[model samples]
Target: MQFIINGETVEVAADIRTSLLDLLRNYLGFTGTKKGCDQGACGACTVLVDGERINSCLALAVQYQHRNITTVEGLARNGSLHPLQQAFIDHDGFQCGYCTPGQLCSAIGMASEIERNIPSVVTKDLSATSVMLDETEFRERMSGNLCRCGAYNGIVEAISEATVPAAAAKTAGRASP
Candidate 1:
């Protein structure tokens, strides 16, 4: 089957039943997307499928044919880190680093959700004038991605920092690592 992953189109000679996670790590050699529980419960295999976060382990490779897939590796450009990646680093959002890839990818998608005005379960008012990025909201949105090392505080902080408005970010200055 053919897949567009990280902006590259490639054909893989694998079984039709192969999971996208296996296709990426086993066939395509993109190990950044981890395999934690091998089930959809763990968000370690999260990836952006058409700009929406999905558990790759639960998706069949054949299902993603011609779909745009963004792995954690795709977030960088020209050797510079994406703001979220830099925020992860600056805020120490990782411990063992096994789950960092999924966390980063999910955070990217989470920011998109906020920008699109998608409300989570914790959203108090769907018709609220603005979306507020608070600790409660961050925790509710990121609950799927587990960090066994318990670096959730840092992860929340990183997402908070990365999601700041561009104008605010420009004036606030980058956080120190």
Candidate 2:
């Protein structure tokens, strides 16, 4: 299968059903994405697929063919950390750091989703002209991601402090996971 990992293009020969998470950690040697709750209940295996967050544990390696996959390690640029990563660090977003990777990737995607006006279950008054970041919207979108470290407060703060678009931030929220 051929896929773009981080910013590199590569090809691999593996079982079609192998999870992208396993291929990344075992075969590709990129272990940033964690394998918590292999059933996909936990967002530990989260990765950005074509700029959207997907639970790698639930996705097959073959399914990623020709798509861009961004793991926790991919968010950095030329040795510089992504803004979200820096924000997480600045806000002390993690204790154990096991779930930090997924949280970061999910935040980027969620922020984009909200910026694009994608409504979530908690979007009260969806008919409202703009999506606003509030406790309710933040919690609903981030419900899938979990943090055993009890760093929810800092995580939320980090995302809230990120440089999301002003229009997006008006409606999209940074919720605790």
Candidate 3:
């Protein structure tokens, strides 16, 4: 089957039952997307499919044929780290680093959701067109992804720093100043 991965189009031969995680890690050698629980309970196998995050371990490769897939390796550009990646390093958001990939991808996807004003369970004002990036929103959005090293504080800080600029800019545009 053909797949567009990290902006590259490639063809691979695999069984119909192969999970997207296995196809990416074992067949295509994109090992950055870790396989933690193999079950959907753990977000370690998270990856972006068309700018939305999904647990790759629970998705069949055939289902994603011809779809755009972004693994952790794709988060960088021109040899520079993605903003979230840099924030992760700057804030020491990881310890063992096994869950870093999923965290990064999930955070990015969460930012997109925020930009689109998609309300989460913690969002207090669902009718508001603009969503604020607050502690409650961040925690609820990132609850799917876990860090066994207990680096939650740093992870929250990094994601907040990386995503707050966009929210600030949007808010500033409506200011009276």
Give the alpha-carbon lDDT of every model. Answer: 0.84, 0.85, 0.88
Query: Over all chains combined, what TM-score does candidate 3 have?
Result: 0.93
Better model by TM-score, 1 or 3? 3
State the TM-score for model 1: 0.89
Query: Where does candidate 1 clash, by residue pair?
Result: none
Tens-digit lDDT track of model 3 for 81-134: 999999999999999999999999998888888778888998878888787666
The parts of candidate 2 lying over 4 Å away from their true place are: 163-177
Winner on TM-score (1 vs 2)? 2
Taking the tens digit of each residue's C-alpha lDDT, what string does model 2 give over 30-140?
999999999888799899999889999999999889998999999999889988899999999999999999999998889878767778887777787666667787777
Q: Give the range where candidate 1 is weakest over 10 consecutive residues by summed lDDT.
A: 167-176
Arranged by lDDT with the best first, the candidates are 3, 2, 1
Residue 123's lDDT within candidate 3 is 82
Report the C-alpha displacement of residue 89, candidate 3, in angstroms.
0.8
Q: Give candidate 2's root-mean-square deviation (CA, Å).
A: 2.5
Tell me the deviation in Å of residue 113 in model 2: 0.3
Q: 1-177, model 1: which lDDT tens digit per residue?
A: 888998999988999999999999999999999999998876999999998999999999999999999999999999999998999999999999999999999888877777776888997778864556565676777889998999988887787778545412322333332
Best by TM-score: 3
Flag regions of model 3 displaced more than 4 Å: 171-177
